[model samples]
Target chain A: AQSVTQPDIHITVSEGASLELRCNYSYGATPYLFWYVQSPGQGLQLLLKYFSGDTLVQGIKGFEAEFKRSQSSFNLRKPSVHWSDAAEYFCALPSGAGSYQLTFGKGTKLSVIP
Target chain B: EAGVTQFPSHSVIEKGQTVTLRCDPISGHDNLYWYRRVMGKEIKFLLHFVKESKQDESGMPNNRFLAERTGGTYSTLKVQPAELEDSGVYFCASSPLPSGLAGVLSSYEQYFGPGTRLTVT
Candidate 1:
């Protein structure tokens, strides 16, 4: 079965610190990957995505993710954490080829400290 | 352009009652999707719609749930005799029809709604 995994349930960081959220997928072949963020009372927003070329993909809100095929990982990262960055992050992949349904990870909640 | 929108951001209902959730996708999008995330669980796909037709409903949990996209415009999902375990945040998403170009990633991107939080007491 294909699955998306975000090992950390929660992560905390001080403002201005670097941030990294891990994501790994198990699949027979490379699948389209994405990262999304859900702020409190807000809809899930697409942060970044990886397909075919350019392993490193940049997204909105100063976030970027690199797709590593050998590791089967597409981890999200930010150079500096903002208090506003505190939100739940999810990793996802399309259900199958030519399909629009997404299979998402459990998500990791990020808490920022002053 | 406006994103996907779901009605009744939050709803609290009795276990045996029926509730209908509506989703209005972006004006020109031909693909709409439904997903749910129960407490402490990953978000899961419930179904997909291509215009007015049901493209795939393999993920629907049971027969008690019925979905429709009349006129290929907006969609409605109704759960009859809702169960306690049915409580979750339901999300609606929309995307443009894929152009059939294998490597074009933009065509597959989905815009999501805020999600309706359903609480069955």
Candidate 2:
């Protein structure tokens, strides 16, 4: 069985400070990873994704994620946090033989303080 | 160039009542998926449809749930006699199928719609 784990339930950070959201995945083979965010009253937006090649992948909204194969992790990171970045972040991976349906973690709620 | 769209942003129904949710995927996207997030739980996959046919439905909870995509465009999901446990946010997403062409950039990144929040009292 494949699963995604987001250890931090909630994280509070000061605006302009660095931020990191940890994610761990369990899969039999090389996994396709993604990071999504949902702001208050908004739909889920793709932050970044890792399919192959470079371990480091950049995404929209100044977000980036690193895919560490040895650690089975794909953690999201940002150098400077913004107030608008406060939202629920989810770590997800494809579940079935095809990479169409995704299995998401319980999500980490980020709170940015001014 | 509209992204995926869902209808009835929020709905409240009795435990034994029925509710239907709709989703319209992006133009030319052949792969559509349904997912749900219950209170305090991770988002779970419900099913997948490739055009007008269901590709996989292993994630569907029970027979009370029915999903249909007519003419391979818009789709509808109906939960008959909704239960209290069915209260959650239902999400619909779509992505283009792989074209098998080199340099075509066949990415599987799914575009999500604003989920329908269903509350069964």
Candidate 3:
């Protein structure tokens, strides 16, 4: 089975400070990883994804993620955190089969402090 | 280009009632999907439709849940005798074409809908 785990349930960062949210996944084979964001009462937005090629992938809103196969991790990072960046972030790995459905993490709630 | 759209942004239904959710995928897109997230849980897959036919429905919880894609343009998911556990946000996504190993090996982005939030009391 494939599963995603975000170790941190909640993270609070000061505005403009660098941010890093850790994500670890367990899968039978190489996985198609993705990072998505959801604001309060909003749908999940695609932030970034890592299918193949580059271990380091950049996404919208000044976000990026790096896939480390050896470590089984794909951590999301932002150089500078903004107040607007305060939202729940999810790490997902879609099954590599007929269905394109994603198995998501419990999500890590990010809180930006002024 | 219009993105995937879902109706009934929020619905409040008593337990044991029936509820229906609708989704209109982007035009020219032939792949449609349904997923949901329960309270404080990860979003789980419900089903997939390639056109008017279902591609896979392995994730559907039980027989009480029904999904349909008519004319391959819009899709509907109905839950009869809704249970409290069914309360969550339902999301729909679409792709320009049927995803195969070629597309999967190339790109892995799937556009998502705004989602419908259902509350069962």
Candidate 4:
């Protein structure tokens, strides 16, 4: 079965500092990759996705992710972090037929310190 | 267009009681999905519905959890004799397949709703 691995469980970054959330996946072929953010008491919102072409994909809220097939990674990056960016980040991969069901990672909790 | 919407944003019920959660997917979406995050565990898939049919229900934990989409419009997941471990957030998602573009495997983004949090005490 396909799975997602988020190495960082908790990360505290100073405000305005760069942020990178690592995500590694285990799959036979390069399945659909996605990044989602869940704010406290909020739903999971899509940050970005990589389907095909363009190794680097840009998403909402000034977030971007690079799909590196060689590394089997799709690490999310932001040049500068904001207080609003403090939330739980999840890396997910398509699991079911035609890639419908999503297999999510354990998730990484981000804390922005001022 | 409205995103996915779930009823009873939060529900607290005693153990061995029954709880039914409803989900209304985005308008015109043919694919609806149910997922849950149990306590400290990662989100797990519960089931998938294509129209009124169950395409994949392999992830359903047990028979106590029943999900139905009678009209293929709204869906309900009922838990009979809820257990303590059933406490978590239940999420509903939906995706649409535009007309004249049938059988195409494009667009896999599933819009989520503000999950329904359940607490079995």
Number of clashing pairs per prediction, in order? 0, 0, 0, 0
In terms of lDDT, the poorest run of 10 residues in model 3 chain B is: B98-107
All candidates' lDDT scores?
Answer: 0.92, 0.92, 0.89, 0.92
Q: Which parts of model 2 have CA positions greater than 4 angstroms off? A: B100-107
Per-model DockQ against the true two-chain complex? 0.84, 0.77, 0.70, 0.78
lDDT of 4: 0.92
What's the lDDT of the predicted structure labeled candidate 2?
Answer: 0.92
Second chain alone, TM-score for each candidate = 0.94, 0.95, 0.91, 0.93
The residue-level lDDT of candidate 1 at A17 comes to 100
Candidate 2, residues B28-56: lDDT per residue as tens digits? 99889999999899998999999999999
**Candidate 4: tens digits of C-alpha lDDT, residues B26-90:** 98888999999998889999999998999899989999899999999989999998999999999
Using all chains and alpha carbons, the TM-scores for the candidates as numbered come to: 0.97, 0.97, 0.94, 0.96
lDDT of 1 by residue, A1-112 (tens): 6789999999999999999999999877889999999999999999988877999999999999999999999999999999999999999998777677888999999999
Return whichever of 1 and 4 wins on DockQ: 1
Residues B32-116, model 1: lDDT tens digits: 8899999999999999999999999998999989999999889999999899999999999988875666524655788999999
**Cα lDDT tens digits for candidate 3, B4-121:** 8899999999999999999998888788889998988888889888888998899999998999998999999999989999999999988767367576543346778989999999
lDDT measured at residue A56 in model 2 versus the true structure, 0 to 100: 99
CA lDDT of B116 in candidate 4? 98
Off by over 4 Å in 4: B98-107
